[model samples]
Target: MSDHRWSPRSPVAALARFVGVPFDAQTYRNLAYLLLAFPLGIAYFTVVTTGLSTGLGLLVTFAGVPIVLATLVVTLGISSFERRLADHLLDVEVDGDDGGIELAFGSVEEAIGTTKRVLTAPAAWTGLLLVGLKFVYGVVAFTALVTAFAVSATLLAAPALYDAPGVTYTFGPYVVDTLGEAVAGGGLGVLLVLVSLHVTNGVARFGGFLTDALLGGAARSAEAADA
Candidate 1:
């Protein structure tokens, strides 16, 4: 078959191709962004969790829901940061040609106003929802990604590890019982790892769709509303 003919013809194939490609050049850049996403996730998780926790406490201690409101307002800032990061690392353009991010709103007063606007604006709320959704889904992605890597690595290293003297760490229960079992288990693990890559790519695509729904839903609805 021609090189083109051998290329991916389906989503699964595409994901396999993606996994097979060496992390070099533009691919390396994309993978690096994914790697860097963890720290960003940690920062966001801390801020939101802290704000919500403290705010709830204050609301309970005092009265009214001002702390809750404040927490939600702080969330607007977090949402904006998420969008910018997506655009920067994933090259996913989120804004309109003219709507422009409100960089002018740099002061605390302006940020408060922006938060108010974000609260009132359906589009902003939608974007926040998307960010929240992605944040939660990311936990699953990271877990699966790491599990796949670890399982695959351990399985592939079976020959060396299992055959080595005084080595008794089991991989899968069945696979570690004997050398033959190790080979079989390692093969299965490799397959599982390959399958995980497909799942990861699917998750990424779903995340993109979510971004569109939350961020562009307003723009689309606005056009429809106009009509």
Candidate 2:
């Protein structure tokens, strides 16, 4: 006879895994990162778009050179911050060396060299690209989170709010007015909440991968070689 075991494929194991998702600390960290992404992404998008456009628009004049260089420097700084943020919240090891160009005022030659390096570095361009992409990612993440929570909350509270004046609960064509239906809705909400947590964590992992790829010097070099 085959020996019985608590395999992950078993129904009980699958249910336990689903139920435990929300209790994980990493899940909350992912949620916090996603929540912060929306506002931070908007800020990043505004700064990058304004700086790049203004700098490029004035490129015909001598003044445009410094403005564009300054924008690149600022972009590198933002990328550095993103690396640290991902390292902390997403638990990803983003490389410390982001091919940063150090500015030195010791001589005119040094300043010129730094500017050339910053303009040429793969990390700088990739970082700028990452910042631009972040805005889109943030919008999607925020929308998904809000929609998930709103639906889950409504379902979870259906039991108590179904009979309230001017309140009605409808799932598809079925009305959730009876106590049994309300309880069922609450159960569904629980499952939805758990599923949402898993989805959030998955998205966060993708964010971590993106951060590491763009912000890490080694990955940037590899990508450049591949290209």
Candidate 3:
């Protein structure tokens, strides 16, 4: 078997890998995932919070039982979708049997059994937690990515914009006015973009990990059985 460790032959090879992050397909996928996280997170959070609050609030009435069950079913469905999304965009394998819950109208006993199973399932609770926290995760990711890309783009455009009338480009303590200074600022911008791509990849990996842990029902069950 060939060794595939991070044993680059030279400093130049290591630097090439670092600089080549933007060209990688996975990096773009990570960017897409992060970009989508904000809106999707908000949607998930809204649905989950509304369902849970409404269902629990009305639990005194007979309608509350069905509502809560329906909410759990919907949450599980969302979890399944998130798992698939992580698999597609982050290239993470989410392996496990999703305990399928089907409410049978024909038999009350079957319906009650299904309800019990869903209520006691570890996956259900974990999935709920994941959905609830998605809003915060989305906001952080969206803000970070937008800020990083915006700053990088601004710096990269400094070379062309610095000389324009009534325009001043400043990078911290240094002001970009001359062509040489603008060029240097542009170079720094390129470096920042590369760094941002790497950071984005790292963030995507963390998201994938969170999804796998919360949604991998079979894996969790197997570990519990082993214990």
Candidate 4:
């Protein structure tokens, strides 16, 4: 009788299949953008909320007019920065529609028109809303990423430290103390670490998709081909 069994060609091949993130470069690039989201989200939320509040609170005062105007101007600058960031990092073409916001350069008239446009454009406010909510996404991503990495690290290191003093491993009610148990736990750890990498990559891709939707406008909608 012949034995029938299936196994991976090699350890590296197994890991590669498990960490099935397409295009390693793209994955890393997405990860880079996701990593920046946390800090950027914080700054965006702080500045925009504070500026809007101050402007509204002081609306009755003579000083309120200029402050409100200045706040809008500052937000226009922030919107420009975000546009550049989305374009460069996500590689999404943000073609504007009627409600789209854009900054023009030329005469003083053009500059004033740009300022007026920024103040009136609905997309500008929409972008601000997106920015304000981005901190929540950042928090969730940061927490998930950190937790996955920590779990992977702890699992991988469990075997080596199992024999060390004051070291204990427990699964439910059973304690892991024997060498056999340690070996089995280590093997499981290796598999989970690969899975964790995939999870991290997935989070990055989701973040990119969301930002693309928020900023890409019609260009993003262009994904659906004509019948």
- Candidate 3 per-residue lDDT, tens place, 21-70, comes to 97899999999989989998999888878888898899888777888888
Whole-model Cα lDDT of every candidate shown, in order: 0.59, 0.85, 0.83, 0.66
Task: List the candidate 1 regions with Cα displacement exceeding 4 Å.
Answer: 1-19, 22-42, 49-74, 96-116, 175-190, 222-227
Q: TM-score for every candidate vs. truth? A: 0.64, 0.88, 0.89, 0.71
Q: In model 1, how many backbone clashes occur?
A: 0
lDDT of 1 by residue, 69-127 (tens): 55555555655565565566555665422133343357878867755654555554564
Off by over 4 Å in 4: 1-17, 20-23, 96-115, 170-174, 218-227
Select the stronger candidate by TM-score from 1 and 3.
Answer: 3
- Model 4 clashing-pair count: 0
For residues 115-225, could you state the per-residue lDDT of candidate 2 as single tens digits?
Answer: 887876666788788888899999999999999999999889989888888987787687888999999999999889999999999999998898887778645575668
Error of 3 at 167 (Å): 2.7
- For model 2, what is the error of residue 107's alpha carbon versus the real structure, in angstroms, after optimal superposition? 3.6
Q: Clash number for every model?
A: 0, 0, 0, 0
For every candidate, C-alpha RMSD to the true structure in Å: 5.3, 2.9, 3.1, 6.4
